[model samples]
Target: MARTLKEATLTTRNARAKLGEGLHWRGIDADTHLGYRKGKRGGVWLVRWRVAEGHYHRDKLGAADDAITEGTLDFNAAVRAARERVEAVRREERAKADGVVHSVRSAVLAYSEMRDARLRERTGSEALRTASSSALERYVTGRVAGGNMEAREAAPIADVPLHDLTEAQLSEWRDALPPTLKASTRRHISADLRAALNMAYRLHRTKLPASFPMTVTEGLHISRKASAEAGEATARENQILPDSKIGEIITAARDVDAAGSWGGDLYRMIIVLAATGARFSQVARLTVRDVQADRSRLMVPASRKGQGSKPEATPVPVGADVLAALAPAIRGRAGGDLLLTRPKMMREPGQLKWVAVGQRPWGMAARLVEPWAEIRKAANLADDVVPYALRHSSIVRGIRAGLPLRLVAALHDTSIAMIERHYGRWIADGLDDLAAAAVVPLVPA
Candidate 1:
């Protein structure tokens, strides 16, 4: 049966517990069949409207009843509120349909497209452009596309109806993520999702009904270091190797021959990592020109994870061990320009073959450290030894040696705040020792 105010009036009388429900029904006008909305908790208001044929137009008005209850809206008032909602919905739908038509998977994809265009304008490398496109594709597929799939399987995350979803719904979705993922990882995903929404809101692509339920700043998990008994450890704990073990590894490294084909340059790389707190990627990208023997500094020209495209030089002092390790490899390097070089494998009939090192410094650190770890295993060293252990060892020793955090960080080409945050235990121990030493017995007692 076609719903009308007459039909709804009867239902309203019977539905005494919910006067709003009865008014919700009564608000509908069958002649101009449109839609109904009911809410009285805040203030009683109802809307009903019909879209005018073949045009984007709606007419509406407000009800005069101050104490609106189970009674229906006057015809004019019903028409007015109905018209406004219908118009608002139409605009929202049009915008959404436009995005669908444009095939925008996520705001990241759109932003990436704009970024690429800017890069192209700047005459950036074709290879870099290709990599950026690949990055965007991967990000979209892994996050946005994956979220959509989850939603289809009743694990809706990305496609959440923002208007309808409550804070509880968002919290449940966050909880449903893989428990194995580190809390940091969960925070990252939440941040990325929030970014997508924020971008959409900015572009008028979609409305975020409220502030994001997950905030990066507050009330999120800060992963605690695992207890020794629990067999879990923080990244900091795992990254620290004893200085004695580092010495042993270096000694073992000195004996290992460059397996006839592969170079022994790996030893030098290991020594550099141990001496300076230079990250793996920074070590890999080291060019001969980046070294300043006169100034006794190694200029790091790039960072793997940072804001800028071309990194500024970070001056790190070259230690005696680092210099000694680098000398033999630098002398015999296949490429005159490269700090670490690979020998030419083959030459085509008419083409010149030349020795070169890969500029893309990816796994150089890992490759170099693996051999020392193997040596450690052979010599029965502790199981906690890792490539990054060298870095942690340097920081811990520097703090123990009473090196100021500022100078230590400058030596390592990193922020003092970072060193203090991650390796503050070493400094705290020194303070404790100093405090104990200061406690002398009273002479006159």
Candidate 2:
């Protein structure tokens, strides 16, 4: 949907120079405006979208193609990028609409659109290292931004409206997904579907019929015990590292450092991971200011899952010893600097030596795979153990220390239901101490 009425003049550098220092506008498909801010030397391209009456938002798309420069955009390219921003805004509006969704298909579409938009907002231009949203959003976007694989896999039952949808119908849908899909894959998709339906009800409760969806109360979560027996569960016994094993792994990370493969990058990352029990994705995104060495806290970024932007950093208390470990990375760095960076490597012309130059962040999760493999071998860790094991190990420690599951979930930024499902078995192991407290009270302390 591109409309280039005034694009001919805006395309050339000579023509743009003549304009005054203000926004020059050209409509794109009647809904969006591809704008250029005229300047003496150079200017930026912008997109203005009016999603609904009386409400509009404008964002910088890139630089105007006045000179051959990075981030500069041509007239045609401006239209293309403008349309993407327009589509994203519209999808967000549709996803969180005040009205009820008529069908599961539409609900899924809305949720997918909302997540994809939010993912881009969350990661900005860094390229999604860890996508807050799932691949279903990609499928939905490719399929007319709504029609791709979501319709293919979750079809037939997707036509049922929320009020009309029953527990049996939802259960059947979950149970009947193709056998070719792995058990974990099936679980993830069902979890997504469950979220979509529940979101719809949560958003438009009053508008829905009195019955609403019965599935909303309990959700489509198949018993974790049942799934574990089926095998390939995401959270499993092997995922949890023991206290002694964690120390061994850290010691091994330091061993890897002697080779200069990771330097302080992996070492510091492991320290935060072990201390905070935060996600690898979260730890990788921390800035120097996020360190807060004085307060002895790591402000974890609140997820931008459903919304268009990051809400705020969640302050999780950490031991002062953890901050002491991070002292090298934090000392004298700018507040906005990345807490951990892989020093940039370069080879001068005609030189055989590759010299370490400046620095770069440990970006994508995939980037860690190679380094992790080497460290894993050094540590003699099991095949199933991974960076995520730090989180599991920490959660298990909290439970064993007699901290409530609800408290553990909050500390780790997850739901109590998740803690109960994955780690509840350990709760029983600690019941003796918990029961002992209750026994003396009843006998009159």
State how far residue 322 of model 1 sits from its true place (Å).
Answer: 1.4
RMSD of 2: 21.4
How many residue pairs of model 2 clash at the backbone?
Answer: 0
lDDT of 1 by residue, 375-430 (tens): 66754667666667777787777777777788777666667776766677778987
User: Listing every candidate in turn, what is its Cα RMSD in Å to the true structure after a full C-alpha superposition?
Assistant: 9.6, 21.4
* CA-RMSD of model 1: 9.6
Query: Of the candidates shown, which would achieve the greatest lDDT relative to the real structure?
Result: 2
TM-score of 1: 0.58
lDDT score, candidate 2: 0.71
Report, for every candidate in turn, its global Cα lDDT versus the true structure: 0.53, 0.71
Q: Tell me the lDDT of model 2 at 261.
A: 55
TM-score of each candidate structure, all chains considered together: 0.58, 0.57
For candidate 1, the lDDT comes to 0.53
Model 1 error, position 197 (Å): 7.1
